[model samples]
Target: MRSLIKIYRATADRVTGRNLDKAAARKQLRILEEIEFVCIGAVAFGLFLEMPSLCSAASLVAFGVLGEFVIHRFHVRASKREQNLSDKESNEQLAAIAEVNLKAETERLKRVEIEERRAPRRLSMEQFNIIESRLRAFAPVEIGVIPTAKGDAEPLEFAADLCVLFRKIGWLPAFATRIDHTIRLGLWVELSPNADRLAQRAAPELVVALRIAGIAVDQDVSRPAGGEFGGTGEEKERACGAGIILNVGLHPVTARGY
Candidate 1:
């Protein structure tokens, strides 16, 4: 009988696509065992009480088959439920990741828009040519333009004008924007430590010339701000070597300093 039971279990395991050691298979087997025991007890009682022997045997067989079917159905339902839950969890995780990526992309695009808005305006060809000619006469100074935050379009326009003017003069000028509390209006010259003696001497005359050209000028030459050129503060200072920084602000051009 034990050998027959083992054979039955092995066959059932293969048919049901489950291992007898697994939880689902073990649960089904336990329930089936209980049903078989109850059925056998009923048959034995019927025989001892002189009831119909055939009917008792038939009842035992029917109960055994029914129990097996019920347990199999239960296992199938449980497996399906577990699968659905797993799928739901996977979907939720994917949705969360996608949402985070979308938010990051949106923020990146927003930053790009702000930068585009802050970009400097272009200078016309005629204005470019004139400024270029004027800047060419002051070549070898390696000037840079730094616009103030509050200067609005005026500073940007001045920087653009300087770029074209300096480019025409055969000098590629560095251009950048910075925030300064003390600066309100006017164009100031910042001299680097390596600046030649001639540039230092010409600085005062350059300021006078700028003032005469309908531009407000800073009276004294100053040092470049920490990060006035580009990159980090130290990098900007290093880049400003032996060069002049032209700071453009919002104030209207006047006969004298603002």
Candidate 2:
């Protein structure tokens, strides 16, 4: 049994080596064929369509045939060389396989190795939200805050992260985010690519929420001409400039608004 196991391992290694050699040979041949096909196709198409003079056409055809001959000759030599190499490698694998006994054990170990590999991505949205909340809380916030909302089309995980981030900082109140974009009372905020238009584009529901929170939109916050967001610093000042600002230091937590 022991001897058989040793032989099996040896065979497996040889087989893997031969397979790699075969793949390399096939790749080289494909590259050569592709180059030949493109060059030949282009020359043939041009000769048939554009060359009007018979002497020019004849010379082109003759030169093309000569090129083809050289290419084919090279291919034949390369093919023969690869075939010999492949056969030799395959024989080695076969010899090892014949001398081996524990193919099942080897196969089992290979499967185990693959199974141990880590998955592509780690954190779920809910989990990421928690982390973002923590990070945001630590992030500095001034009178003005960047109110970011992932579009409705964004992935659930991404949305959760954004919300979590918003909650952590002074940007949003605790659990301030909701899955629904509209209020049950028939109020909703408008979704737009441009945040500057929020005052105009935001639905009645969103404006009401901001108003309720004491975040009155400053009409006097003149829009900057050269840039967008209307000088966010000024906007923050406006928010702070209000008679009173709420949730200035409070953590974002969820609460229902009618």
Candidate 3:
């Protein structure tokens, strides 16, 4: 199919170069007609002279000329047919390509629409109750809800909601701190470099609490964010003895769990 198109294009280009588009191979047809006429006159003259040799020769030439005319006529028709076939098939191929491209673009637009409707990962009221009850065992622990910066607001919104919950639980700071840091993705647990055994012991329980409520926390326990913030707190009774940071990050395309 491809080769046929190529041949057709090349032939068309040559025809165009010689200005054959309008001429319709008329010149060649005229030349063949003239030759046939001359052959017919020769045969007639030979027969009038009563010469068998001349008559036979002229008769053979006339037949050959007739054959040439027929061959040329059919060749033109055949070429026309080939050109028409090429044109039709080429149009069909282009139409198919255009349709495929349009389908792909339509799919892309659908994905964009879905993304627009997609809501951020949320924590429900029942999950909140479960988490609050679980945290009661790790009360007095300090938590800094830090949400990472991203192009989309989904992470920020989710982080803000989670921050409100932690604040209401009385373990987090006033609000979530917005920081420009390139760190690990998804829900991560960050521990202070100076975090004592109390924070270490509470880390597993915290993971369980979040997971039990169906909140996906990705990592086990990562060290502090390169000492970006001090884990130490005010030394007093009921103060945060076990300090941990919940680094709220962008949601992953695929959800993972323990």
Tell me each candidate's TM-score. 0.34, 0.28, 0.39
Q: How accurate is candidate 1 locally (lDDT)?
A: 0.50
The candidate with the higher TM-score, 2 or 3, is 3
Model 1 TM-score?
A: 0.34
- Each prediction's Cα lDDT score? 0.50, 0.41, 0.53
Which one wins by TM-score: 1 or 3?
3
Q: Least lDDT summed over 10 consecutive residues: which range in candidate 2?
A: 238-247
Q: Please write out the lDDT profile of model 2 over residues 1-258, one tens digit for every residue.
A: 456545545544543222346667777777777766765775696577767787777777676666667777767755765776666666566656654535666787888877654222222545444444443433342111222332322223333343444445434432233343321211112222222332232223233444444433332223432222222222332222112111222222213221
Residues 120-172, model 1: lDDT tens digits: 43445664555444545555555556665634674576566767676666654
Candidate 1 residue 149 Cα shift, in angstroms, is 0.8
Model 2 segments beyond 4 Å from truth? 1-21, 101-258
- Candidate with top lDDT is 3
Candidate 2 backbone clash number:
16
After superposition, which runs of candidate 3 have C-alpha atoms over 4 Å from their true positions?
Answer: 1-117, 174-183, 221-258
Pairs that clash in candidate 3:
none
In model 1, the Cα lDDT at residue 144 comes to: 51
- Against the true structure, candidate 2 has what lDDT? 0.41
